[model samples]
Target: MSSAVSNQARPAEAGPARQPVPGPASTGTGTSGAGASGPGPGGRGPATDYSGYPLVGSKHPWRWVGTAAVALGVAAVAWSLATNPRWEWGVVAQWFTAQSVVNGLLETLKLTAISGILGFVLGFILALMRLSASPLLVSVSWTFSWIFRSTPLLVQMLLWYNLGYLYEKISLGIPFTDVRFFEVQTTTLISQFAAAVLGLTLNQAAYSAEIIRGGILSVDQGQLEAAAALGIPAWRRSTRIVLPQAMRAILPTAFNEIIGLVKGTSIVYVLAYSELFYTVQVIYNRTQQVLPLLLVATLWYVVITSVLSVFQYYIERHYSKGAVRTLPLTPLQKARKFFATHAVAPSRARSPR
Candidate 1:
């Protein structure tokens, strides 16, 4: 009886048992307070905070400083050039559009066009020969490329100009038939312009052959096999399939060569062919305005090269089909888009009532 009374007394003395309250189930609503309608603490909800995962706020102060420094340097140089009287800006303007200069410009363009066409055509044939199965053809192509490329273009030009010294006559006829169809004095056959074209074309063709070969090699061997499997004729396979693809690789370097050829036309000054550079020399010799004349030539070259570069950009874009998902915007398009995006005025925030 006493033990039972003691147990009852112990129960009466002890406090009430506390029961655990169940937390709310996550609703992915990023709230976890009373009704789960607001952020819980530290402005973050019960859901794990990943807002700071990709950490920001890293700064590189030197980049801005360097950019500003470069801009200032360029501006300074430009200003100095503009103000310097030694440049003889007046003389540059005077002869910039002279008739002789214009004629020289035309001649330069002519040489570039003819040389580029002939060189590329011959180069294409040489490339084909290099890729041919016949040992004799390969050897001949290799030897031609080797000889032309190894010799200085200036030397070649000189040699062609003086061809009369080596061979008085050039003949075209059936070999060993004593039936000459045509014969001409070497000097008469090769005028200064003709010699320049021959030299430029031969030199350009040698380098262009290597470039073409490289482009052809860049195409996958599997592509050739596939074309062959389809029973495509060799010519058709090369021209239709392989060459089209190879052009993507070829165009950039080929354009570079063309531009070089444009500049290379200047070397014909040695033969006294009156291209742009030669024209400049003639004017400078008369006027003794060396700096201005040189500047004129430099500016013309820059303009021509710039135009070619622009053309190259468009051609490259044309050939980049299927290679890139989206074409890049033109400068005009980019400028228009930039102004459209940035020219708008921002809305002003209203004060709270």
Candidate 2:
């Protein structure tokens, strides 16, 4: 009882219990010293002997099946194209770069360039008008878009071509006076080219206005307000802050519209203008090689659209800088990655021991 009482009464030893004297192993100091962890040399975990096991890749059976099916379909289409005699591929090759066709192509390009530039410029102004505080500007913008967009493009082209029936003369003169600065007969003034340009430009403007307005609206109002609060001038704020952000939203749709316009130039054929489609029609009508001539036009259109698509991709990539951490890979980059991964893997697997 006294021993127990003395043991209990004694003050506890200070700090921790006495530790074992550290040897080479515990101190990890000597060349041959091994730690208590029993790990590989240099404290790494044991080296796994993966060479003994064969790797089994994850199964994607459905994916393989889908790929096989698509390959077969593509092969069938290619075979059909090869064997079909009605395609008259020789005629297509012959006339593809003929002088007449080239001239028509130039005309088509001219129309597209002029109409696209004028349409977008007018549309930008109309978009501003639509978004303005004044009721008159908004109403005028709305009415113009409504009338143009609601009517068929074909009708507009016809109406513009036939404007002479409604007005004997077109003039720039005083509102209610005989004095005139310029005057021309309506029939002469609204020739085929002039009428086609007028119709396409107006129609394009109507759609472009909406596209621009939507893009502008997509920009956050808070940013604009913040810019204003920070005393950034309205013009600077619009050009610098709003436009840059809004373009990201606008570009994809805008490119689609432009592409559509390229095809839409076909409608100008009704006016008997010498655009690509009209030229093709004339050739086919004369030679009776309808399919081949049409094929030539189709190929040219495909080439144009493909080029535009490339431009669209690069432009979008440029604008995506702030939106994405990494820019999306280009087709060339993707191809390189694909080959590197698959080709390297197969070669590595077949490598000698």
Candidate 3:
């Protein structure tokens, strides 16, 4: 009787016509059909659900614009080369690979290196002057810095070249009187090369002084206080704690300035110094092929600059040791890993959860 009652409560089995069937509508398609096409009881089936706007990830109008700009630049370069008459590779190669050009390049490099070292040394003293408590010392340094920085490098070079015209001789004399102890002949005291070196060094010192000053100022005030609290001498504190940190801060800028000075030595050609540019001018004047000679100078500059760039990188890495991370991989290793990961990823079915 209980089994019959249960069967009666369950209701008679429905025929196919009365039974509901799962359809595409039940899967959120929202289409109406009897079989899989019909919506289920949930009423949320896939339908002509074009009621919402289409999804696009973020749009970048500027990216398209930049791409167009780069395309135009490349086109312009190609057009210019085709139209211009300056594309003689033979002359360029000959002059570029000349022995004279090589010598000039070496000389240019040496001058830049020597002048830069001397300038940095002098600049250190000037930086100290600017930081000194003594008003006189500070004023003197400020004046020197202003004069050199205010003047153009070309003007300074010219002035040094013609220094003999201003003074017959500069004598070591007592102040306010012509009580001369020793005299330096103006002509002998300043040669073209000497003047070039002097001008470059002095101008560089002014700029480098500011670089150093900025570095020193970047040191934390609390660090200085701590050093004082520890009873460290003022000089010792500066040299030991402050200067080392300042050097690290200033190294990158100093390296850039050094590179600039290397290129800037070309300006010495105005004085007829037989530096790289002047030598190139002499050769090209004789050869009468200006473009080729210029190209030679440029190539030499590029080569020397490349070498110096490596040195600068090493120096920067040395100073940046504690500040920045060294990469885990060498460039080649990193590139290899990158390609391998992308090209040989594990198959999805083989991948572990």
What's the TM-score of every candidate structure? 0.82, 0.80, 0.71
Pairs clashing in candidate 2? none
Q: What CA RMSD would you report for each candidate?
A: 15.8, 16.0, 13.3
What ranking emerges by TM-score with the best candidate at the front? 1, 2, 3
User: Which segments of candidate 1 are over 4 A away from where they belong?
Assistant: 1-57, 339-353
Superposition-based RMSD of candidate 1 using all C-alpha atoms, in angstroms: 15.8
In angstroms, give how far residue 27 of model 2 lies from its true place. 42
Best by the TM-score measure: 1
| Model 3 worst lDDT run, 10 consecutive residues | 9-18
Q: Give the TM-score of candidate 2.
A: 0.80
Which stretches of candidate 3 lie above 4 Å from their native place? 1-85, 173-181, 325-353
lDDT of 2 by residue, 26-130 (tens): 435322212333343355555423342233333466887898999999999999998899888899999999999989888888888888888888998899999
Q: Model 1 compared with the native: what TM-score?
A: 0.82
Better of 1 and 3 by TM-score: 1
- lDDT against true structure, model 2: 0.84
**If both were scored by TM-score, which would come out higher, candidate 1 or candidate 2?**
1
Stretches of candidate 2 exceeding 4 Å from the true structure: 1-57, 333-353
For model 1, what is the error of residue 277's alpha carbon versus the real structure, in angstroms, after optimal superposition? 0.5
